[model samples]
Target chain A: MLGALKRLWHKLGSPRWFFALTSFWVSLFGWAALLFLLVGVVWGLAFAPADYQQGNSFRIMYVHVPAAMLAQSLYIGMGVAGFIGLVWRMKLTDVFIAASLPLGMAVTALALFSGSVWGRPTWGSWWEWDGRTVSTLVLFFLYVGIYALREAIAEMQLRARASALLAMVGTVNIPIIKYSVEWWNTLHQPASFGLTQKPAMPSEMWLPLLVMVLGFYALAGCVVLTRMRAEILHREGSARWVGEWVAGRRGS
Target chain B: MYFDSFTEFLQMGKHGLYVWLAYGSTALVLLWTWLSAQQSLASVTRRVEQQAQLAARNTQLAARNTMSGGAATGSEREQNLAGYDESET
Candidate 1:
């Protein structure tokens, strides 16, 4: 089994294969995200009934929840990439981690901003210092630090190593951000709209949320894939074939 | 099925601005981020190619300079040899 697994890993680890395979997956996820998002937005915004207490304002959940979920997952992903980059000295892994930064920041910002917006309507305030909110805020800062750290270093290899280290260190916030509500008596609601358990909502409420979640995932995937491809091109520019490939692509 | 009329939906039962702003800003910012990345990638790619082109051109120029110097050296030697021959005669 280990041998078989090693063979599979070797095949998948090829840059050519990874690029080709990622294109396929990105397209699939991109389209699926689009379809799911469309259904989610229309259903959540137009079709679903308003909440008894929150009214139409509750529809913001479709955006807020998805962004929050994406933000959480993207950070974990970057951390994993950082680990791979540090362990294997894989250029692609570092590139992937770097490429993911902007998207992750966007999602984190969206989650925080939307949460603030949602807060004002529901809690009569636009900001809170609760554990959940505060920890997620720190996650956003960690992302910024990684981006800034990478940009500050002049040497590319050193930059990647340093930023990856920072990312690996910052990953402790993921679990804390996730369980902040359960860990403390925060104002934020506990996880009811989870993936595994049944959502504490009617079909109308849950279905749109599902769509939005998938859509957000699609958007993130598309963004990151594009970034990764560009990073590959940038890094490969010195290769003999890269110049010809660039010329061909440019001509086309 | 949700709202009785457009007014109620717009009203958001009193949270219209907050709700719309939150969702709208999220969507807009996402669009901006994607567009900006594409721009950055384009610029970076262009810069790398330009640097490569500049390096190749510099090598060509250096070769030309070296060739010119060699020919000039030969010309100076010939000129000096011609003066010596004339003076000896």
Candidate 2:
């Protein structure tokens, strides 16, 4: 099983094969993302019971929590992909990094913006230099730095190597962002949902939140795949197979 | 469904502005991200197609010039080469 998994991993190094494989999966997940987001948003916004403490304002959790989770996860993903790309010189891995940056940046901004918006009423302030908020803000800057680094370097190989190294080093922030609430006192609340323990909120509330989390992930996936497909085509456009593929697409 | 009517739902029991702003801004940002990415992809793809067509035309022109064996003029060939250089830049 390990060898089979390794073989599959190696096979994915081929851009043509990877692009073909992702096309079908992208479509499948695209629909799933739409359904999950629609159901989760509707359920959480309307049907779920109001928060006794925060009242209806708590509904923001459905969007905010999921966006925050996605931001963190996407950063870690960039770290892993950067590691692979740097070590193995896998071009596809760089493609993953390039495709993820814009999405990650947008989502991180969403998390911060929404978090502060949630904070305004609860904490009576929009901005706080607390552990979680500060670390997350740092995470956002790291993304900006990665993109800027990529743009500054003209050579593809040097750009890839530099950005990948930066991504690997920047991963130190992910842990800080994750543990910030526990590590220090912060206006930001500790995670209410966890895998090892029962959720703090009631099932109705948490359940929709669960759906929203999955939906946001799927949505992120769809966005990445869509962008990745374009990146792949642009990078591989000169190849003979790409010409055939483009011609075929045009013909169809 | 939780609210008595659409008005109360919109009102969100005094927290309406905060909740709506959060969700609304998030939606707008997400939509903006998707649209911008899609637009970038479409523009890049179109550029790639145009570049490919230009390259093909260049190759065809070169082939035709070679086959005709000096039938094509020097000025025309230079102009074609110049176009190639412009495309590269």
Candidate 3:
């Protein structure tokens, strides 16, 4: 098992292998995301019971919670990828970082936008400088900053190293974002899902939420893989295998 | 199904605007992300294909130039130069 795992790890280091392996995964995940999102959205929006206190407005949680969770998770994943790229200098790790940044930025923006919209009805204000809100905003800025840092550098190695370092450093904000609501008085509520406790809401409500969260993950996976494949082609354009691959694609 | 009618479903208990706005914006963002990824992939594929074609063309041109340079005799070279001079005139 260990030997197999090691072999797989080595294989993952090769861009061509990674690209070929994930080609089918992109579409698989795309279809899964579409199905899951459709089911989750329809169920959450029309079938699930509305909140007694907040009413149907609570349905916004379907999109809001998933986006918020995915935003943080993507950042953490990027940080881990950065660490791997710095330590092992695996080319695919940097590809992952570069490919995931824009998606992370978009998801973070979605979370912030959804949160603010949800807030207007619940908190009676669209914007607040509270702990959770501010920390999440900082997370958004961190994505922008890393992306800008990458764009500003022309040398490939320097750009990868700088962006990896920044990604690793930016992880500090994640924990703060996660704990912000608990650490300070804020308009935002506590997390809906936790490992140690049952959800405060009924199964009917949380079930569709679970589906939406999983669907969001699938969506992220699909987009990131597609982008990573593109990045690999961009970086490996001169490689003989890349040329062959393009020729093969043209032939087929 | 939760509401008596589609209108109530849209209304969302007087918070229709907020609920729809959140979902609408989220949908738009998700759509944009997917479309941009597909676009970038297509663009990169086109670029890589173009680079490959350019490289092949360059190699072919280089090979042809080298062959012509080596195979041409002095007379043939002079004849080509004379042809070029006549075209210039």
Candidate 4:
């Protein structure tokens, strides 16, 4: 099984094959994203019961939780891709890193923004130096740092290698960000929702949140796949298959 | 449906501004990201197509130049040199 998975991974390293393989998954998740996000947001905003303690402000959870979760998960993804790129020397892994950086940064920024917004109504303040918030802020900057590293280098391969290295080094912070809330006293509540165990919130509330989380992941995947496709085409522009692919697009 | 009326729904009890602002900003950012990704892909496609066409044209021109020596027909040279512009990459 391990050997088979390795073979599949190597096969997927080919730019043309990767592009073709991801096309169907991209479209599938694209539609699923639309369906799940629409349903989840509408349901959470309207149908779910409001929080007894925090009232309607808790509605922010539908977006905040998912964005925060995706922020960390995407960072971890970048780290893993970086390791693969550095170790296996997979060019596809570099493409994955480039494609994910912008999306990850956007989601992280959104998480911070939503968290701050949620803070105002509930905590009566807009900002705090709590461990969770500060660590996440650092995570956001780490993403920015990687992006800046990419732009500062002129050569493509060098830029990718440098950024990939930075991504790997930054993996150390993910755990700190994840555990900050529990390790320190903060106004931010613990995760009330979990997939592996019983949820702290009632079914109706956590259910929509669960949908929103899945929707966010699906949406993130679609965006990354779209960007990765473009990166693959650009990098493999000299390949005959790419020329044919471009010609096909022109015909379509 | 949880609320009594549309106004209350829009208001979101007392936290409407916070709720709407959070959702609105996130939606706007995500939409912009998606649109820009599509635009980036389109731009890359356009660039790749242009480069491929230019390369093919250059190859064709080079071949034609080699086929015809310095002593060439007026019409052929004129045709060959007519508005011929290409970036040497």
Top candidate when judged by lDDT against the true structure: 3
Give candidate 1 misplaced runs (Cα > 4 Å): A1-17, A20-27, A250-252, B45-89
Better of 3 and 4 by DockQ: 4
lDDT of 2 by residue, A1-252 (tens): 999999888888888888778888777777887888899989998999999989898999999999999999999999999999988989888888999999999999999999898888888899988999999999999999999999999999999899899989999999999899999977788999998999998899899999999888887888898788888888887888777766776799
Instruction: Give me the displacement of residue A109 in model 2, in angstroms.
Output: 0.7
lDDT of 1 by residue, A76-133 (tens): 8888888988997766778888888998998899899999999987888899899999
CAPRI tier for the interface of model 1: acceptable
TM values, all candidates: 0.83, 0.93, 0.92, 0.93
Worst 10 residues of 1 chain B by lDDT: B80-89
The true-versus-predicted C-alpha distance at residue A161 of model 1, in Å, is 1.8
Q: Score the docking of each candidate (DockQ).
A: 0.38, 0.68, 0.70, 0.77
> How well is each residue in A20-92 modelled by candidate 4, as lDDT tens digits?
8998988888889889999999999999999999999999999999999999999999999999888888899
Runs in model 2 lying further than 4 Å from the true structure: A1-6, B71-79, B82-86
Residue A61 C-alpha lDDT in model 4: 94
lDDT of 3 by residue, A54-113 (tens): 988899999999999999999999999999999999999889999999999999999999
CA deviation > 4 Å runs, candidate 3: B65-89
Across all candidates, the chain A TM-score values are 0.92, 0.96, 0.97, 0.96
Winner on DockQ between 1 and 2 is 2
